[model samples]
Target: MKKNIAKYIEQFEQTLNFSDLSWWIIDYKNDPGYFYCNKVMANTFNLDINAQKHSVVDTCPIAGDYIKNVHLASTNKANLIIKEYLELLNQEKKEYNNTFPYYDKNIDTVKYFSSKAKALELDEEGNVSILFGLIENITSKETLSKELKEYHNIIDTNVMTATTNTKGIILNCSSALCNITGYSKEELVGQKYNILKHPDTSEKVFEKMELALAKGEIWENEIKNQKKNGEEYWIKLIVSPIFNEQGKIKAFTTINQDITDKKIIEKLSKKDKLTNLYNRAKLDILLEKELQTFERYETNSSIIMLDIDYFKSINDNYGHLIGDKVLVQIASILRSNTRITDFVGRWGGEEFLIICPNSDIENTEKVASKLKDVLEFSDFGMKKNVTASFGISSYKENDTVDTLLQRADNALYNAKENGRNTVELIP
Candidate 1:
């Protein structure tokens, strides 16, 4: 009988050797229980063949309480497979499944484990023997899941309207983004956001966009972008970044609102109510920018200041209605003669200012002469060959806005001095 029992024990040990799981058989009824540990279990407890006679408690001091609990559960034949015990084991078999303070020589750090324990019975003597368990590492998983959920929520709930990200790569976009951009989720992924860049948008503005994104800065501004149908519209965009576990930027998110109608209203605000020419407010802004460009690039530019000749007589004799028609007709002539780059604005009542960027003194005189000739050939209802006298001044370095306007005004006096229907350059 003893020989057969030893053979059975050897066979059981051999069976455990074939698997990766760690296990051990404990004789609970015996004082200082007998332990038959598999290779994995033996390694876990740092036990050798010579240490077989020692109790499990003596060999694995950290797991002493866990073994005692399993023994107590075995006395009642309670099932304990992966059940929580006071001593918990982690996924790594090198450590006990317990939350006790212990120094790890390998990692030089303290760690904890929550383990699952099971009771196994062998023999009819009611001698509860064997405890089985498995441990899993969950610290990193718990932290990562929490952070990922937070990031997902932010991307999913963006307000405003348009889709954002460089190249339209929708890292995180809201329903509003999809609606405003006219692109489905599947269509927007990995696409350039600038695919919507409007033709009217200057290249310089796009360069700023690239610079801002590259530096990890938010870019908030109004930009003209195209729709899926190639129609242009304006949007106010606020673009920001998304960071990952190590604080590295992983993606970009943008909130945008359509502002085309607002932009139209703004443009209307800068125009003269009657003639539709830009008003003085717009002219001042244009002049200031052009002057800065001239100073920076050392470019030549000219200003033509002019007024309709004898405008009071027409309003008094022919009524304000005819005067209005004459003004509209003059505006149409000016618009037709000027290049698209020139700024033509109504400088309050009959007076007009034409800014010619990159035009020299001689070219300005020629343009002014052409303006006088064209108006002379055109006849009004009863005004009979209405004319305008122009004062031209070429921009010079260090000239302030007031100085430039004064020079142009002096040139107008010269034009009136020379002849009412003639053009003259300021001396």
Candidate 2:
């Protein structure tokens, strides 16, 4: 019987040496303090690896203390699993498995491991005498899982997110989305996605979005949406198509950023502070778009540049406050007189521009003449009637924004050169 036990011990040592796992055995019958610890396990705890057995008090004090005190010391949430696992290993006769953290004194770092242990031997009284254990390092996997959980938490808090089926029915929405839209998750789920769409948003925009989605392509846009309170808001939305294993579209995920305040700031930035008219920068952009339209479709368009006649003298005669009021009134007049398709902006100090789309030189000249007549008769809150000189330029085959504006500027110069309150056209 002693010889058979000796041969089993030799075979176990050979088995431990041939494998890459960390393995250990504890003996509590004949030698309570002495235990078999393979090289991997010994080196993990900075123990004497060459020795076949370790003494608990002298050779591996840290290891012994850790194993003995783990249940008492591991009261924190991060180590609760380890404590329970140790209890089961010590008390139960069956195998138990767990993942826990261990402090390695050799490298002075905490390493995670998936470990299992069982009672390997029982004494005559059926009390546990020997225990066998195996552990595998899983620090990297735990670390990655922790990082991914953190990232998910961050996105859930900050992004207005939702998932929808292919039919545009809402499946789920994040809390942030509910907060921004003033809708509860229960109200949003199982509803069509268009419930939040503002009427002012053109159907063409939705058509384009649907077209892109049908192609399994991502679509991004700034959308005007209405909240539950009927208040309007804007969102910069990105919709991505989720795919299945066969690469077919399964669902769609939307990531949205609340951009209402940004849109307000941008609108304010594009307008004149006092007059609430588009400033020169915005006018330049509008003019470029008009130019592109003309170049693409050969559509007729025109630019009308006008300024208050003797505007400096009006400022000199009355206070600048009255002059500002006069400008405001004139802006209102221009807005009321122009067609809905025309774009009006305050070009600069005392100068304004109107971009007329799909209008020829003759039609634009008629528009300038009409505006000139309207200004000549309008009251500007002053004793005298306010008048303005108008300059008109129609789009040519190869006209640039600069060249177009320059021609209108020259036409305005000609109008001012000829007389103050007249209309002039440069074809």
Candidate 3:
């Protein structure tokens, strides 16, 4: 309302577009008194009425020459209308309405306007004193039509985005979304948002997301989604709820950021660089978790600490490169022969640790014994068979990680004392 009343009137003109009044007022004998036009007036002429009581019209760009050149044609026509307003006042007409085309110099555009002028008060001779005017911008309707087409083009040029109904049915998806998901717009639209959800994403996770969104909160999560080719990919998903006038849920919008490479790198970080088995650090995390499980439940777990017998001699004879290959072979054998519930890790050079959850001392000994027989028999592509000595210890009641590991290390020393390729149990 402050900047240019004309522009405000034009913007809301759509609601009152069919209505007659986009109001303006003028002094019958002077400049345009009070004028209001909507966006069209701003777009066309950059026209503004001065704060003075006299009806003076000014063009923006504040420079004298640009203002004079820009508003010259429209200002002259408006002044002529003011002269006519006075004549109508003297003729005693209540109001006069008409249409005119103006050449707008700002953007070099041609605009059309429908205007109605009314006499406010009359002089002693019954002459018109002040005049009221209403203007409807007919050209702005065409301008809005052109703007909408350009807006649609701009929106589609960005990142992967999509929209859906309140019930989660897909309404539309961008081409970028189609390219990433390997689905066409035809295939994606009308489908539920879950069409791309992976089976690994549990229903509980979806329920939690739905509950958050229902309360009008934005929900963000990393989703493991399946592509059309059945290959899995990772994405950071952000969903926002669209609200209607009545404060009711209208629809939803989702933006996706592809994070497949990041997830792959994170997985590699937890693995041993040489053997690709988990490194010692990762093994410690799993071990602590197993201990926590034992603390909560009375169920037992065990650990096996082992190292290759005369591994330095093997490295010396065949070179460290061959030593690494032999270790990788040993690691492979350990991985293939162990149960899924067990964990085998490369516990530093020439050493390995096996975590056996739900296993007692007797059961742990059997596992280590099996690993020993495999190491003794498995071919290492070397002149002699490689041997590994294992020390087994099970979790005792209220035992800490340090205590359990110390007992296993002690037992491993005894296994070496008792000779290699033997499984020794801690008391």
**Regions of model 2 farther than 4 Å from truth:** 1-17, 27-34, 50-52, 55-82, 89-95, 120-130, 143-203, 221-238, 253-273, 280-300, 309-318, 365-427
lDDT of 2 by residue, 304-419 (tens): 99988889988899979988988999899899999998999999889999999999989999999999999999867678888889889988888999999999999999999988
Separately for all candidates shown, the number of backbone clashes (residues 3 or more apart, or on different chains) is 13, 0, 7
Q: Which segments of model 1 are wrong by more than 4 Å?
A: 1-158, 161-172, 178-195, 207-220, 226-233, 241-251, 257-270, 282-301, 310-341, 357-359, 375-386, 394-404, 413-419
TM-score of 2: 0.67
- The local lDDT score (0 to 100) that residue 342 gets in candidate 1 is 88
lDDT values, one for every candidate:
0.69, 0.83, 0.76
The estimated TM-scores of all candidates read 0.49, 0.67, 0.57
What lDDT score goes with residue 207 in model 2? 95
Error of 3 at 83 (Å): 36
lDDT of 1 by residue, 97-199 (tens): 4322222334544333334444444346633333444433344554576689887666555554334444556444566566666777667666676666788
lDDT of 2: 0.83
Clashing pairs in 3: 6-37, 6-38, 7-38, 10-38, 24-133, 31-55, 32-55
Error of 3 at 286 (Å): 2.8
Strongest candidate by lDDT = 2
By TM-score, the candidates rank as 2, 3, 1
The TM-score, computed over Cα atoms with residue i paired to residue i, of candidate 3 is 0.57
